[model samples]
Target: MDEKRLCLAHDDSLRMLRLARRCDDLVLAPAPARVLRDADGSIDPAALVAALPNELFAPTAQNPVDLRFDDDASRSGCSLVRSCPGLLRLPDDAYLEVLTAEGDPLCVCGSTVAHVLVEAGPLAMTSAAVTLGRAVGAGRLSRDAALVRLTGFAMELCGRYARDPLAPLVGDVVHDIEPVSSVRELRAFLDEPTGLHGVELARMAASYANDGSGSTMETCWYGVFCLPPRLGGAHLTRPLQNVALDWPAEAAGLVSHERMRPDFHWPRYETACEHQGGDHTSEQALEEDSRRARDYELCHIHYLPLTKKDARDVNAVTALLAQLLSIIAPYETDAFARRARRMLNDEGVCAARRVLLAQLLPPRLRWCDGDA
Candidate 1:
């Protein structure tokens, strides 16, 4: 057939037919080469008859010849004269051997796992963590296996060269998955001989990670507070989270519970830091805060309640850190004193702090030359 006639025939076939598969020079069965109903749901016999090839109309009983279209026009060129209904219904990751107009085998809507990971970016860690948690919660995955999987993803993502590595974020994800592993388990993972990227950062993050954190925001607060001051951080000792406290009998009705557990605490100084965000605005929350404050006063422990705004303000955080440091200084151990002395003179810490500062701060707010 002439090229024009072939093109016209293919176009007409595609309009009504769903191409199942095309073998070498043959269009196989199940291609559905007929439309029995019109848009108004009326049977169109003439339309169906017209859609079928001449071979189908003149068919004998036995040996049937498969319908064949011009290979040059349908398979070897950029022609939209073929439709694959199966391909349309499958997912983007599904693999199918489809031929281009040039008759070259091409993948239809398939992509690698690495490509999907790259496309997801930093949220991939959060997503994987959340998914594993849900799976465990639903009893689909065991808690131990889920922790391994979560840590595996953390290893993969954090090892790569990324600004917001998975190390720091994995803790919150693991926390959400409940019955989280001990810090020892995380350390064991870190010690394993795996080809994980960014090992140093991963180790550092694991050192500071704790399942005791109540929320992602609490994790963020912990991270920022541990870094040196030059990096928009407080350089404070890592505080224990959600430490249980005994409340006086008089506070039983005023607070929600007879016992109190502060959000973050320094046991050495008996100082506690409470992070008050929108959840503390209720009347019950106000009463609880008041009762907690009175309880701390009775116990002779310092209480500092901070808001999100306090955490965001660099100067405010610095001042709060100073207060914490002063209170804890008297109780600082010889070992801690030695570490503090070393920190003051450590060039490596200074360099690392500069890199961390760049990562954490916005470009405009970052330290410039001689700005301190």
Candidate 2:
């Protein structure tokens, strides 16, 4: 892999994740020195580490934020793990973790320095895939949180966002280059990844992953509904995410719209799920939502509407799951409902999953405890 790159050592995951939210990749003010390159033109790790800044300016819980996420404890230093000889066994929460490397390693599976940059003015920080791979290999996060991030990263790799590796997490898509990666490509990436740790875990998480998420919460909720019961979910059949559908004549007339795009849809069951965020509270959006519900009634497609409030509540989600199972009639309706309750209640498998995801997820995308 001779691609020009700027890599982050997977350390202090919280700090890295914070920076990643601001700029998915960093565009370094490239400074060229002959020491950075070997005679063969490959990157010289020792030279690169000494040349780069260990830390740069960033937010302490998303800049200019409310009192909730930001605090004094979050003001800790953001260290950039550097590479040199004897680079092995870093703190597990090390920068862009490297569990192992190939025949040509950056270090002994524990240290990583940036690759030989193209020296094209500046260098970008790190790719979402690289962050995800490192996080998984580091083995610091809970499996649920790691898998959620893996899925989100895979989605970022797909569609318009693929073009701008440095695009902000919540920014508009980049239209310059067409998307060329998907969850499948992510799997392929992990298969022969540029030496890192936790290849197997990342691969396994990718196996359960799908793309086409509109937001972090959407991705998290999808995992909630689709992951097997063992993973603290109902294990329902996976559904298509954010797909456009040609509405029937009756449906269009009912909603006064010709096109219908459901956030989550199951073709076999003819059911759909929509996640309502802050934008949905507007007067116009409320009217549209009312019309949409009417349209669903006319079309006979079972619709499930979820909001941030519904997402975080165990009783609410359990009740919602029961209703969904009743329509599908897969298992005894009451059983699945009760199962959801057991899984999501305090100290339940899903409850723990939620707590961790809330902590690990990026800025403005957390399932904060008091927010709901």
For model 2, residues 177-235, the per-residue Cα lDDT tens digits are 32334566556555553454455555666676666766555666766677665554667
Give the Cα error of residue 33 in candidate 1, in Å. 50
- What's model 1's TM-score? 0.43
Best by lDDT: 2
**Model 2: CA > 4 A from native:** 1-140, 159-180, 192-196, 249-255, 330-348, 351-372
Where in model 1 is the C-alpha error above 4 Å? 1-180, 228-235, 246-256, 279-282, 333-372
CA lDDT of each candidate?
Answer: 0.41, 0.48
Number of clashing pairs per prediction, in order: 5, 16
The sequence of per-residue lDDT tens digits that candidate 1 reaches over residues 1-372 is: 100111112122221111212123322121112111101111122332233345323322242212223232233121222311211121121111123345432221222110000111122233344456667779986544444334333333322111222233322122222222345554665455543333333444455445466544454455456644333344677677775876556654555456677778877678888777458888998887887788787766789887755544344444555565556667877765655546544565444434443333333332353311
Clashes of 1: 5
Worst 10 residues of 1 by lDDT: 112-121
